[model samples]
Target: MDVALVLIGLVGGVITALSPCILPVLPVIFLSGADRERRPYPVVAGLVLSFSLLTLLGAALLAALPLPPGTIRWAGLVALVLLGIGLIVPRFEAILEAPFARLPQARAGRDRGGFVLGLVLGTVYVPCAGPVLAAITIAGATGDIGAGTIALTAGFAVGTGLTLMVFALAGRAVSQRVAAFRRRQRAIRVASGVAVVLLALGLTFGVNVPNYATALDHEFQRLLPAHVPTGSDVPPALAECVGQALYTEPPDESQDCGPAPALTGITDWVGTPVTLAGLRGKVVLVDFWTFDCINCRHVIPHVEDWYAKYHAQGLEVIGVHTPEYSFEHEIAGVRRAVAREGITYPVAVDNDYGTWQAYGVQAWPSLFLVDAMGQVRHVAVGEGGYDETENLIRELLTTP
Candidate 1:
């Protein structure tokens, strides 16, 4: 383990143990407990185990096991949907009633310790970190079970634990105010149930909203300078697509979007297909990225915005998710990535780096611009070329 990474894990753990979002749930878990002293410990343990289990599951998914992203997302969405339906529909209320109603017969007054508590808490407590945690876990599911999984699990546990510990400290206050908050609790339960349903529905269908991404891509173009260089140095036919900019020099060998790789598979979340060949009549910008890449995280918002603005104008934006880790392979993680980032364009997953190698991509955010003739145009290695790229896209879209 890298000593620095381990230290980072420890810090993440401590902070998670103290976060505000998770702290409030501790009291509820305690109140759900039949025993008093055993309250916080069990809940805390459950929450910890949940994080550990989910993290481990994530690591496993990254291994590219047969499990597909749609399956997991659908399963989780089903669970949340069922829970929500139980809350909203009186006829379906029996589902929620079963847990509370069967509590007496199920436990037989037996006390649940840390592990059991942890399981229950994890099962019930829906942390705001769901999407991020789910993405990490999905990534972990890809490669390296030994050190990578352990480190990721440890980091996740610490992050969640740090937020939960504060709840442990406030458990007593939470217990005392139970009665005064009963009405509020009921309302919360209803809201939570609805939220789960809504989230599931969004995951199932609403993942295609494209407003944010379109806006950001536009901002990138608008930021360009007034004058763009172009002339005899540039191809007469391709000059318009270059937007008055000359081919300053050959594209960097490292930034080259290697020969277009064979299309092994395609999963369309937005049903938009802007292939390398399809863009032969216009300019194309291919974004090589993964949902979990911290750098890609910042760039996606802009990518989405750019796609919406320039796509109709003949700029084809194809986001290739060449995941760096295993968890990124999960379709659910990809779907969440698209939804969370508000990406409306088409994305292809290169979990195996089949496409990554095809493009010879080596960075989180490598952009490849292909001219109207289908040859590589310009390439940007890292961040901070939004305006230049957008100008190129605009020029390409406007070309005859």
Candidate 2:
């Protein structure tokens, strides 16, 4: 068990807990803390236990079982619905507690409820890929779930649990002592329950709440990827850069990976159909991304910022919108996400992974920096490298 990988995973998990990626499930986490009498320990513990197990063995388990895709996630949502109902109606809550009524510490308010909820929540909590997490995912995706991978997964699970545990504890303390919460305990409890149920419903219906924590997430990604050096060609400065790079050479002002792949097989076009040949003589930054991807969400804000600042200066940013899931392939969904993100640039919908495969994109939110000559100049995967990417764009735009 490499301790460094464990630490790297731990740090990445902590940052994820603080990232906008965690926004979707925050209501449930808060509710876990909202009950003043409930022990949040069991909830966090079960979350760690469940997450670690799922990360390491979920794919294999799914393959062996005849379960459909996302069965566990749906089960978690169902569990949340039940938990919310339990909170809203005290009778249901009593019934939920009935199974443990004869056990010792039956008077214990939290006893087993929180742990059960955590188990369910863990199944629903799908984390975005960061540097360390990408490795774990590759390991899982490739059927190489070894002991070392298990250790790293456990570290991430425990670290994520710790950050969330702090939030839950804080919520519980506030509920216990805060004047507003104390004044309307029952009403507040009911309101919190409603929020949880509504969140689950929203998730079930595929309604994505907009994220405001992108900038924070962007910063948090910087602290990840501190594992032991693998004698790769990554420069000392970029030693902590996101993931395994397609380019092992040092960053060059004139870095060209060869002529860029043509944008083809697009399902639909958002705004207008703009091709690479038409966009010649302009420095183009082709963003290979999907709407539902959390990393893509974080990356878009920065891309939007650049487009706004540099469009007139001859920077043409084209977003090749690829679908990571079935829902993301919908044109309406793509339009909604684009409008929601305030994206003004043209987005090409690549539902068939046509452009994705053409460019050999391995991850969501990949940036292919194309020079004015229509050649690929630089590439960035996952998150971070905001300043570096921006600087590269500046250099490319200014260069002949």
Candidate 3:
């Protein structure tokens, strides 16, 4: 295993925990073990195990398995629903905890079946990662798993697990501290149960409340590193390998990635249809995103700002709306998202993922800056490159 990549992955995972992409799942992670008697370690352990394995093998496994579309997601929702019910009903909760009652380790990790709860959450958990996770997902789906991939995946899981541990512990602390809450464990359990059920239902229906926690995410991105800074001691080849994935560097415009791929197989359009070829002689920002992704939601405002600020000056931002969930495939949802976000730029819905594959999109909230000459100038994957992207846009607009 390449230790450097693992380190990079570790860092990537920590930042992702702080990113807007994980915002939606933070509450679930926080409340997973909020009960005074439940331990957070086992839940986190289960979460890490599930996320790492699934990130590496989930796509290929899902495609190869005979299960119907969205089966795993549905099953996960059902599991959470049952777990929630177990919390709201004491007899059911006792029945659920009966199996883990005697085993010591289970007592610790599966206290109130926390491990199982984590496992269910992990199946549905979608956290945005730079090239670290994208590479793992591709490697997993394409059967190209290797030591480096495995190490990076492991490191990312560990980093994310660390943060999740903090949230879980915090929840436990808060639950124990307030005498009012401590005295009413049943009520606390009911509240936690209701949260779990709501989360499950939201995922079941692709219901997402955008702009949920932007300020917190802003602080995270503002303070954390987004990519490996320039002139690090890392090997040049290694840096280039993960360049598409970003590591937290001060943006440099000297990058020459390649030409932008043709935008194809877009089944619908929210504002209008646009092609890379037709968009020539213009500074184009192609944002690959889905409506339901939290990170994408966070990134949209910046895209809107840029489009509003630069559209008159030869800037064209095309939101290539891709689907991560089954419901995002519908145009009606896309329209609502666009309107809600107050986005006036064109949106291309690539339901078939043809455009996604065309650009080798590794994550939602990915952006490619194309110069008027129709050459790809810059790529920002997984949020947090606004200053650099904006500066580059200015340079491109003024230069050509």
- As a TM-score, model 3 comes out at 0.73
Off by over 4 Å in 2: 96-109, 179-184, 205-291, 298-364, 371-375, 381-400
Worst 10 residues of 2 by lDDT: 241-250
Model 2 — TM-score against the truth? 0.68
lDDT by residue (tens digit), candidate 2, 270-374: 998898999889999999887767778778989999999999999998999876433355688889888988999999998666676566565567788888898
How does each model score on TM-score? Answer: 0.50, 0.68, 0.73
lDDT of 3 by residue, 80-149 (tens): 8888788688788778777777776635533548787788778777665344565676566556777877
Tell me which residue pairs clash in candidate 2: none
- What does candidate 1's lDDT look like per residue over 96-168, in tens digits? 4444454433232222333343453454343322212322433444443456436645765765665565555
Candidate that scores best on TM-score: 3
Worst 10 residues of 1 by lDDT: 224-233
